[model samples]
Target: MTDGGAMLPWLVIRQDDNGNRYRVGSYATQDEAQRIADSLGGRGPERLYWVERMGQAAPS
Candidate 1:
């Protein structure tokens, strides 16, 4: 997480086959984030994309 993305709470995330997650970008609405994620979807069988609300950190 970083500064500036605080206002836009929606996150577009990409996870590779190795299970490493990366933040693509942030949006003001979930729909907007999901649209970007969906556009990037299915590019590769091993790559996965989705949207999540920012500020909540997952257990490591």
Candidate 2:
């Protein structure tokens, strides 16, 4: 859970050349998530990485 009651709202998403998307990871802060995506970007030219903020949802 985070400051505004969102549980791991920051998401790191990856997409490959084949048009398949995957949830690489989740984070409490956007910066942390972006850093991870940036690091992964250099690994493959055909793979795309980005960060997104998911809707706020309370933890179970």
Candidate 3:
């Protein structure tokens, strides 16, 4: 987690070959997660949020 809520953990949502959500992933850095989320590039139209992993350890 980051102070001032500037940068925090995040889950990079992705789908499997069959088009199903896979396991929820947590990242130490938000930048890394953002990259994964960016790869998704929005499917047609969907709501998304860039959030931190609750009760998860912050970047060391």
In order of listing, the candidates' clash counts read 0, 0, 2
How do the predictions measure up, each by TM-score? 0.78, 0.77, 0.38
Candidate No. with top TM-score:
1
In candidate 1, stretches whose alpha carbon ends up further than 4 angstroms from where it belongs are: 1-6, 57-60
lDDT of 3 by residue, 6-57 (tens): 6545666544445555434666677887776676556544434343465544
Give candidate 1's error at residue 31 in angstroms. 0.4
Q: What is the per-residue lDDT of model 1 for residues 1-60, given as tens digits with 9 covering 90 to 100?
A: 445645788899888899999989988889999999999997987878888898776434
lDDT of each: 0.84, 0.82, 0.55
User: Worst ten-residue run, lDDT, model 1?
Assistant: 1-10
lDDT of 1 at 47: 79
On TM-score, the stronger of 2 and 3 is: 2
Residue pairs with colliding backbones in model 3 are: 1-58, 9-52
Model 2 score (lDDT):
0.82
**How well does candidate 3 score on lDDT at residue 3?**
46
Error of 2 at 17 (Å): 0.6
Ranking by lDDT: 1, 2, 3
